[model samples]
Target: MKQIILYAIFVIFFTWNPAFGFLSGPIAGRTGAPDDICGTKSCNDPPVCHGSYNINSGPASFFITAPSSYVLGETIDVTVSFSNTGSGLHGFQLTALDASNKRVGIFQSKDNTVQTEAYLNEYAAHTTVGTARTSWTVQWTAPLANVTYPVIFYAAGNQADGEGTPEDDYIYNTAAVIIQPTSTPTPAVTDGECDAETIQLSQNLLELQKGESREIVITVKEENDCVAGGVSIKATIKKGKKRISLFPESGTTDEIGQIAFTITAKKKTGKATVVFNADGIKSKLKVTITSK
Candidate 1:
């Protein structure tokens, strides 16, 4: 009995990893070719291995590079690159979270504030991937107003076979988006109150697509919430899946509650949830379109 207990303890000790436990999985997706150990062999001839059982995956690595420091009210640009180099398909997802792992901010729901990265299998040539193994870039710019906090990047994908590998989820790497000391100070506004009353109702979400036209409209509202001036006021928009900036500038609201601006192909393709911010207030709306 003592020998049985000791053997079980040794086996458990050898299998634990500190960072993530069950996140890894069995091989996933259909197999193009079996491992050398099981090449063209029947079950009786050789045994097969399984892992991350959703899709084939490889080593996934990414890095975030931004301006050395951030400044309040100044737009700071962030760039990230992802690389897949394993035998199977390896991929990941992205979002911004504070050091404590809480997602904070109004990205993409309003102004199309930032854009996300897609795998080559999802899009055409935006970021090429194949046997050579390369990195793809996704760019986003946000107005740096919050005090320095850690931002996290999440990357997730499928695992092909059931060999207990990282083909299904984030397998190889992950990190926090870095922010340097702010050149300007942040105002106290963490109470969860976003001063939303200041937002104009007509101006809502912005739509984004990879290679199509997007129309965004903004306006300055009077005390009664009517358009005081057609001059374009500012706002931000985001899509729910992942925040991607559609346009850099505000859209022009015409006499009516219609503000129209077009998003170009340089911006990739995906569904986006938009939010409009104005006069210290914020509001939300949705726009989703497919590219030509």
Candidate 2:
């Protein structure tokens, strides 16, 4: 009779222990699934661990970090972190989806603590429940084709106390949105008219007090002095990126072959240089900021 009791206790202990049991299968897309539990069935299935434990109602303890914008076909780093440092073991599932709720990016990671889900290549989850970690980073490659909608990264993290049961454990879910780069309009070509040869700035030097702003105009022209409209132009701060701000950093020339930029001086009193590129043609502007 004692042997039977011990066997039953052992079975119950392992059954509720997340480290040794539970979540035996892949856990992709389960972050936003209808059911809060992990690994009982597909993301579309109903809740199976209803009486096990109640979902935590406190502030989110998990967060995702990703770039605000993504270029087509580019690979960017996305990281998931847990705020609860006291947890002994951690597990997570993450996936990126488009506005339509369809998976949109591929995830890759070198960390042994995490792996891509076997059922869905897009979902990345913890490799094992036994590994104790606070954060995981994965490289996500944006789709090659243009996805007009924003890409949202969903992540769910489990903070376990490693106490051999689901009691006191918490699950947190969060998401981040990444926008697509603005599209540049194509230029209309007329016999040598679109050949950009020079970039002219309205002001080569700007002097401003702290917290002041000034506007400058850029013009693109061809060898024959013809205005080159629809020319893609990019503005970069060569120095003192933190001391000054440039607005409309990148844009296309209007029909008059002109584009405008607004430069604002920050609290710092320093000099900065802004470089402008218009279809290979380059120009530089100097800016000096003084204390008010």
Candidate 3:
């Protein structure tokens, strides 16, 4: 009877308790929490012992690395690294938001170690908890259009002592910010004549059969009618659903102020409009896809 009671106690303490640990990933909205209610409250609740969980304080054990500036509609890589060299398993969650607090970018995991949450599709977390991972890399695609500057990337990570419970574990939160590159004004020319900078496309309209592909060249010209090289360009689908697709959606012009993109017709047959932005100048291409 005594042995049975001891075994029962062990089961209740280790298995029956609800505050063991996430073991997978934390709940949604747990990154960069402004309060304890939605952040570490559940993890630090009863049934589990508490430990030091720091929020954007002390020697940062968790760090976020990303470009200081990003081009509109471009996909950038963001990495979250754990600097603590201690012996333990680690897990993390990362996300980005605009100044309005609205989720700004789409996050995609580069490997199986991380997974994008289905709740808002904005949160990326570890696939399995309690792993000896030092860092995670995720792709974040900027919004199709420019929003308020300074998109903030927030992340939260934990170092677990490989214990089955939350005790002796440490949680850390940190953030980083990125902004859009500012456009420089073109200098005025006092010459005989001046033409405003323009974005010219090889073809303004396209007709392609289903599963057909076509390439288009974009050229940028300055006010002096000279080819302006090294110009940033971004393309976005303005109309139609997913009937058409474009490759190299965003890039910089070559030495000849030219960039090429391939457009392909998908299964659906319909009309689609692709808007292109060269620096601040804008242009559009109309595409019609028909049955083969």
lDDT of 3 by residue, 180-230 (tens): 433323334333333227886655666555776666667676755555666
lDDT score, residue 88, model 1? Answer: 42
Error of 3 at 194 (Å): 25
Identify the runs in model 3 with alpha carbons over 4 angstroms from their true place: 1-21, 33-60, 117-119, 181-292
How much does candidate 3 score in TM-score?
0.51
Stretches > 4 Å off in candidate 2? 1-26, 33-60, 117-119, 146-148, 182-292
Poorest 10 consecutive residues by lDDT, candidate 1: 1-10
Candidate whose TM-score is highest: 3
**What local distance difference test score does each model get?**
0.32, 0.61, 0.62
Clashes of each: 73, 0, 0
Each prediction's Cα RMSD? 20.1, 17.7, 20.2
Arrange candidates by TM-score, descending: 3, 2, 1
The candidate, 1 or 2, that scores higher on lDDT is: 2
Clashing pairs in 3: none
Residue-level error in angstroms, candidate 3, position 177: 0.5
Give the per-residue lDDT digits (tens) of candidate 2, residues 1-292. 0000000000111124554464432334456422223322322211322223223233346678888777777888898888746756677777776644457878886567667747356877766542466788878988987443446676666666566654555555555656544343334557655767888664455555678665666767776656688789999999989789989889997765767788888999888999999867799878777664
How many steric clashes does model 2 contain? 0
Clashing residue pairs in candidate 2 are none
Error of 2 at 104 (Å): 0.5
Taking the tens digit of each residue's C-alpha lDDT, what string does model 1 give over 103-199? 4332221112212222212111111122122333344344344421333333222222223432233222222334433553333332233222333
